[model samples]
Target: MFLDPLATPGFKRTLFNAIVAPRPIGWISTINAHGQTNLAPFSHFNLVSTAPAVVMFSCNTPADRAEKDTIANVRSTGEFVTNLVTWELREAMNLSSFNAPYGVDEFELAGLEKAPSLKVRPPRVKASPASMECKVLRIIEIEPIVEGDTTSHVVLGRVVGVHLDERLVDAHGHFDTLRAEPLTRLDGDRYAISGRTDMLGRPSPRRD
Candidate 1:
């Protein structure tokens, strides 16, 4: 079926996320100036560049129309940790996404352990298989594409430190994606895991 977001009067913001298929969950952890910690998942996240090791996640305005704690904390502290979510921690990750108050600590609410990060004030999820400690490059407020679009902010961070569970790595140093079983974001309350695995090589260069 053909759908035109701009033309449709009842187009949903979720349609964009749903059409994009499974997206990696950026289980971000951040701390405010007063040491208040927050954790939230953002599906609009990905590695933007490799040379400088930068990653980005987009946070949308909530129903309350107030600034989200995650965005405010990241702006205040200039740091955050992207904790990789796996099937094992799915429930905890979901629990942390609740619309808690500003000072509420989601880690404590989720009953998850927080491990000190090496290069950032924000702690990492101890149960996560991997985490990227990042310094905030910038936070850009996204302009509305259509008139009624809610406010959104894109947070870009430069990866300053990384943590990988040694148990998930092989002797050759390749981290097993299948073993990690990373959780992915889906439409509504649905979620997915990296269940199957395969590889495909790039085509050879065409010779004249």
Candidate 2:
């Protein structure tokens, strides 16, 4: 079956998300200029580069046409934190995804405790196994091609500070992802855990 995403009648965007199955969730935390904290989850989030330790997450404008608190906070303060969601904190992470009003503290709403970041103003989730304190590199506005399509803001950040629980780190200083039991997002209402991870090595290049 052939499907033209540009011409699809309904759920095209959702279909796109499902096609990109099992995306990592960036549980983002940010602070507004007035020092209000915001926490939210974005499945369209990933590490884009390792040289400078950069990560990015995208935020879309809702039907109300108001900027999300995370986006607004990032723009306001130029910093944000990426918190790793673990199996034990799955319910708290889900609870924080609620569409609460601006200035509403999702940390309190989700019953999660906040830990002060070392280099950034935003606080990290105390329960998270790892967190990245980042400075905003840029925010790219994704313009819509067709009418009625919403705009999305892609926020890029450079890792300035990192917090990792020693329990998840090995003697070699490598992160034990399975031990951390990180959580990921599947299409709609579905989620995945990384407890049973598989290791694969890249093949050596063949000489011509």
Candidate 3:
């Protein structure tokens, strides 16, 4: 199938998301200026850099209404936390994405516990194997989907602190991802877990 993006109107409605399957889910948590907590998940997320430790997530901007609760919260407070979505927490993570009204406490709605963050005001998922507290670095607005309909915004955050489950860490300080069973989004409602996998090592340049 030769999918020409330029010819296909609303190309995203086609195979854009499906082709980018198995995206790591970033279960985000934030607190509004009034201290109201909110939780949501974003499949459009990934690590941006490791030197300064940055992560990014993208979300749609409602053209006719206010921004998403999570986005608004971070804009107001300049902080948020990225909670790892593991297999066990998948259900809660799904429920927390509900389009609830403003000031809704998603933690209570999802029946999940929260843990204090060291360098940020937002709390982390207590049950998550890992969480990264971040400070907002920039929010870049992308071109609108169709102009006056909806738009997308990319958020770049600098990881200020990280909380992890000690059991998932080895003596060499490597993370045991297989043991954590991190969850990922595969297109639509389908999802996947980091289970068994093959391994390979990079060849040394000198070996040639």
Clashes of each: 0, 0, 0
What are the Cα lDDT values of the candidates? 0.91, 0.92, 0.89
Residue 11, model 1, lDDT: 71
Report how far residue 207 has shifted in candidate 2, in Å: 6.1
Ranking by TM-score: 2, 1, 3
TM-score of each: 0.94, 0.95, 0.93
Query: Please, what are the lDDT tens digits per residue for candidate 2 over residues 47-154?
Result: 999998999999789875478889989988999999999888989999999999888999999999999999999999999989999999999999988887889999
Error of 3 at 109 (Å): 0.6
Q: What CA RMSD would you report for each candidate?
A: 1.5, 1.5, 1.9
Compose the digit string of candidate 1's lDDT tens values, residues 61-128: 88785778888888888999999999999999999998887899999999999999999999999999
TM-score result, candidate 2: 0.95
By lDDT: ranked, best first: 2, 1, 3
